[model samples]
Target: MYARLFPIIAVLAALLAPAAAASDLTVFAAASMREAMERIASGFEEETGTKVVFSFAGTGVLARQIEAGAPADLFVSADADWMDYVTENGSIDAASVRQVASNALVLVGASGAAALELEASKIADFLDDQRMAMADPDTVPAGRYGRTALENLGLWQSVAGRLAPMENVRIALASVARGDTPLGLVYRTDAEIEPNVAVLATFPDTSHPEIRYLAALTEGSGNPAAEPFLDYLTGPDAREILQSLGFVTDKVE
Candidate 1:
């Protein structure tokens, strides 16, 4: 009886040991950053032995969640505004804020679709009465960029009524991939990952504000591993991974 009980206790201790030593992390990132972050997080986990959990959504939604006391160790936004929103609300450590990546907006459509010139003057003719899928222009960074580009080129007023707003940029990409929408405006990185979607044209950088991605540690985070993970993001490892995923790393590029 004693020998049998010893073996049971040893098994129980072994099962509990990993749980005791594990460093659990909760990272909130923008929907567009999902794929790249997953790859980066896998590397961070392999090296640090920390289980990095993620919550991917629109920057506005994630910012609101952090502001409302969500258990997030880090926050990564697709644009500066949402990060600014959380910072002003005192939800993140302003000093830890870093711009990690950049992306361009592009016009995408179902595979095999005819290519359009991507000029604002000819954009209306390209739509052909079909609604353009995009994230909510009021809140999503990608949508805001698309809207700004259209307005800058005098195309917004003409196509305003034909916009199909999604909850996030990924959904906009999905809409085009699924052939639910004839056209979508999404980050260039998003287009790279979806095989069913064809990139028709890349919006000119001069067409809108520069797209930027920012990452920061949350104020309420007490995790010791959070700093290392955040560091890895701005470090060389993450830059390589992000660049492979079609994100522009560093400001000079």
Candidate 2:
């Protein structure tokens, strides 16, 4: 009894500008940041008149693309491992790397599902006989964190073989929202945007590595807005938008 896999979320351009101009910026970001990044990009375009072009996918996928010489002005990764992946491959400017935000891990269930504690026995009973939805624990950052959290709580065996693993966090969120699964493990911010899913249990910070989103300029990027746009992401306006969407941006860097 192993986990089942679902279709991968297609990697696609998010904010497509009419055409690439000198002032246009191209960004590669994680799928989990799609909504927040789109909002931040739109605001960046409106305020600076610099059109932003985006590609959203899993952090590992985007990191490999950048390593293979993808043309991107900036890269925002969901975790440091992938950021370190690109940095080690010289795909991004290590000097410009900075922490943008951090997030908490959570368990979610169909809307109106009663919130439950993270205790192994309680979760097992709440789930009954259904599988849980989560990102691919082997590759996706959210899944990796989720797995680690479950293991930390002594609940890994409770749902190990009963998982419906998707390619990314949003897909897992969709699974619970659509009632395709009884529960899901995703970032708190991810659970916030989907109205059909409610937080059931929260994983403590000690359960896994600190979840962080790091942003940096890609190597050899000469786009004029590349640096400024990266700076704007951690600025007051962008931070405000991110916070509104339930993201935590308390970093002083």
Candidate 3:
């Protein structure tokens, strides 16, 4: 009787030990990905019976944080450039990097603003009294793409004085949505989140660099749960969610 009871108690303890030791994985992602990624992470947590913690900001800032020893299990960057930065620095596995989603750059404006037909060449005309908002091009990929589009359309130099640089694309979108800035360049998904804003125009493919969303597991993450989350982001369910939020499914070139 003693032997049988002892074996049963040891098995129960073994089972409880793993449950108690299970860790919450930390994911650092770009500000633009916050809405969709949070939903996906919530679903992942429910399905896997694990906890997920997130930190969202500009990809450049997140990369710098990770380089400075921020404890993160996974990273989702707004573009390939910052993903490359972490990979090159040996902070994450290069082979684990995958393009998760793509986004189109769009010009947005307050819903109550004048209805203007925006063509690539006519973008500057829309910026007359309206301040145009964008993320800081020096630290945000979306801002760099917006700048490139403006330059390609011969509007960047002319509109330089009319620009409001936000910390991230999400903030730039917020400025337009709140009517603080009448116009902004942001991801199409960001515009979708704001009922007060209207997408005035999408940048022509030839007008700017393609925007790609990339993700990878961090190098020193002790959490083995990171891989599954990365895999889930590329799965059908996650893709469907992303599509519903206005993200493009195609990979950026």
Candidate 4:
């Protein structure tokens, strides 16, 4: 069911706090990029001696924070629409926008759970009366993609009220990994990092809009490291990290 998630108010407050010191670069990135982005930032810190700080959240939340002057040096979003939102609102420099990576959507369950067909009638059978966890389908990119996949396959009606939607893709992944939810829908990259979750099925690329990760330097950011870090994210090293984490780094589409 669609549960209200007002608890995020506290989270938003923290993310919207004052900007970082000039010596450190502040980045607001999508939740699904946590592990990979951390690894990449660590490498950047080692190589350039510039510290990188991050605020990871859903694309919708990050975009809103940026719009309200979150003071982030950079913004990376899983959904292009959210990036467009920030860009249109003057939160980020539109000219610096670039597609960094692409990802696939997947259905996952507890590690030992059996896999099932990605069919319309079979979805309910697969759920087995338990709610399938998902990101907030209305605003979150992964959730929106999952819902669109189900709708495209005529399975939306079957799972209508049978959801345990969370705030972001990572939370949904965590829920299934911890056995709090038997099933969840998340990015392939997100599923790979959690050993306790098994990929039950992958959503067809045609089932939803293209899944692309876009990065950009925040509009009028005076921090010198901002542009460099954004470039590093799309560099070979970052691409390698993204591919190792199961993200499609070959092309943005």
List the global CA lDDT of all models: 0.86, 0.85, 0.82, 0.86
Question: What ordering of candidates by lDDT runs from best to worst?
Answer: 4, 1, 2, 3
Residues 73-157 of candidate 2: C-alpha lDDT, one tens digit per residue: 9999999998998898888899999998889999999889999898878887887898889998987899998999899888999
Clashing pairs in 4: none
Error of 1 at 135 (Å): 0.8
Q: Distance from true position, residue 40, model 3, in Å?
A: 0.7
Worst lDDT run of 10 residues, candidate 1, spans 13-22
Error of 4 at 218 (Å): 0.7
List candidate 1 segments past 4 Å from native: 1-22, 119-121
62 Cα displacement, candidate 3 (Å): 0.4
Model 4, runs deviating above 4 Å = 1-19
Q: Which candidate is the best by TM-score?
A: 4
Lowest lDDT block of 10, candidate 4: 1-10
Every model's TM-score:
0.88, 0.90, 0.86, 0.93
Q: What overall lDDT, based on C-alpha atoms, would model 4 receive against the true structure?
A: 0.86
Question: Which of the numbered candidates is closest to the native, going by highest lDDT?
Answer: 4
